[model samples]
Target: MNGDIKEDIRSLSLTDLEKFFADQNEKTFRANQVYEWFWKKSCRSINDMTNLSKPVRKILEDHFSFPVLHIEKEYISRDRTVKSTFRLHDRLMIEGVLIPDGNRTTACISSQVGCQLGCTFCATGLFGFKRNLAFTEIFDQVVELTNQSLHHFNVPLSNIVLMGMGEPLLNYEEVKRAILMITSEDGLGMSPQRITLSTVGIPNMIRKLADDHLRIHLAISLHTADNVKRSIIVPLNKKYPLEELRDALKYYHEKTGKRFTLEYLMFANMNDSLSDAHNLAEFCKSFPVKINLIGYNQVPDLDFKRPESGKIIAFKEFLEKKNMIVNIRKSRGEDIEAACGQLALKDRNQREG
Candidate 1:
């Protein structure tokens, strides 16, 4: 943070705000009012706190800044999926998506500017790591997408998936804080159950998330069950292999007593074979889990192709035959590059220019 840059007011806790008001010889309740405007009301500017006196607003304006992530550009797919390029205060860019299904809409938000986990199938990995988004930045994505949902689909955002750019567990602290704010009564008031954090199975961090017991859904991006194949695609697998990941997931289940989701992005002729399906089934035996067989969105220069429709059905049937809960998740927003593994910042040079 530069000295010239005023601190983000949302970074202060309720207690910190209350203390600040008391120090200014103001009523402590003013902090509660400001806090409500910050989170519950989603106020973008201090002047939007209409309930506050002008003098109080002046005090806030003088001390702290209310910077917001503004949309630089947005694209709508044929299926009504909206992909937005959000410009951060520092001029860094990130992406978010709003997918409308019937009456329900899901907002997929990014946790980091770019991903360090170099998954070969994901475009975000190609851009390389930049920085973790502040908790406020993460929360702002949801607010903006919620507005988009109402504007486009005439429905409120029903769910949130941290399945956008970077791995959530890699940026644990800020991600956790953002989740807390999103689910808290003082904030958006969305249910914890409505949120899902997708990650590439960081072993120790998985254990940490399990112990913390955040109560949100966990979805692992386990494209393949075979370690050698997994390592080739998801380079992080070479460091924390499938065995360790399995143990960590087992611990998560034992600790939380929750069934997590395994997201399998089916690649044609690679991990879509019957043997690979058998390996995936065997891997699921240790813990209670549901499987989401996702259709891979074709990224430019990425050789990984979507499996044939028949192969995808066969894979889903194989799991169903073994009494597993399975769903073939339809890839949305491929045209706008908002589907899974496709959220690399395409407007970087444009924003920089």
Candidate 2:
């Protein structure tokens, strides 16, 4: 009999769980207890499941492992931005960051190892694509961050952004499932509104995401408004240019009636001119778009530099004058490569050398 076969704690759904216990000649209620241990109790080890009989606990110990990321290295910036490298089971390195403002706590989790979106200005693009993170792996990030922070601060994490190291839409199924699981009442019990998914403008995934009509915030990495310029900075723009992206945004706004946030990383003397801001405002007229003006966080591998504060203010003012909603995003964690794409633990040049 296959009654003694073990199951991966992270991979099994509630249905597979029932079959697992059934194979063991145990009642279906046994599976629910196991599932709750993962989602509710968040036990450190299988032995911590005291509700389960000793034999069942032994069975679980022989079979399952707590999907976890081992913290290999950590860096904290003077500006209070904290970034850590988590080594997965297969030696894949991913980064998680905690950015704390007075009232807001944002934890950035990586969806994939290296990104396929070779944006010219991104540091991760320099590192070739590796693999996607499983749903449980992503869940592990939230749990670990929560556990770490609970010891330091009183409040739980207030924000979760899929913006650490990879393009989330490329791994849509796992990403979607992870989000659903994270926001599930039985799971993390986090409200959907507290999560945000950032994408590099994959139209197919964008359309599907809109169809899902998830109430969570969707932020688009829109660095440039001109198709030609955008195509150079963001290669995906070739497939979904300004026109197509506008159409997608319009559809998303229409379908969900949810306002989307446009993220613009301003590079000094590159794409932060007065004309760039004007073009940006003109492009976003089709739907309600909130503009977030980000100062390009500098990385040694990338040539792009953050625009001057005066220029950024001028750009924001121009958008406001045109009756567009815009705000300047203050740069955090610049001290220790705290910029979005700068947290690359592995040296790409050294690998190639």
Best by TM-score: 1
lDDT of 1: 0.92
lDDT of 1 by residue, 1-353 (tens): 35778778989999999999999999999989989998999989999999989999899888888889999899999999999999998888999999999999999999998898889998999988878999999999999999999999999999999999898998999999999999999998999999999999999999999998799999999999999999999999999999999999999999999999999999999999889999999999999999999989999978889988999999899889999999999999999989999998775594352
* Models, CA RMSD each: 1.4, 2.7
TM-score of each: 0.97, 0.94
List candidate 2 segments past 4 Å from native.
1-7, 63-66, 346-353
Best by lDDT: 1
Q: How many clashes does each candidate structure show, in the order listed?
A: 0, 0
Clashing pairs in 1: none
TM value for model 2: 0.94
Candidate lDDT scores, in order, read 0.92, 0.82
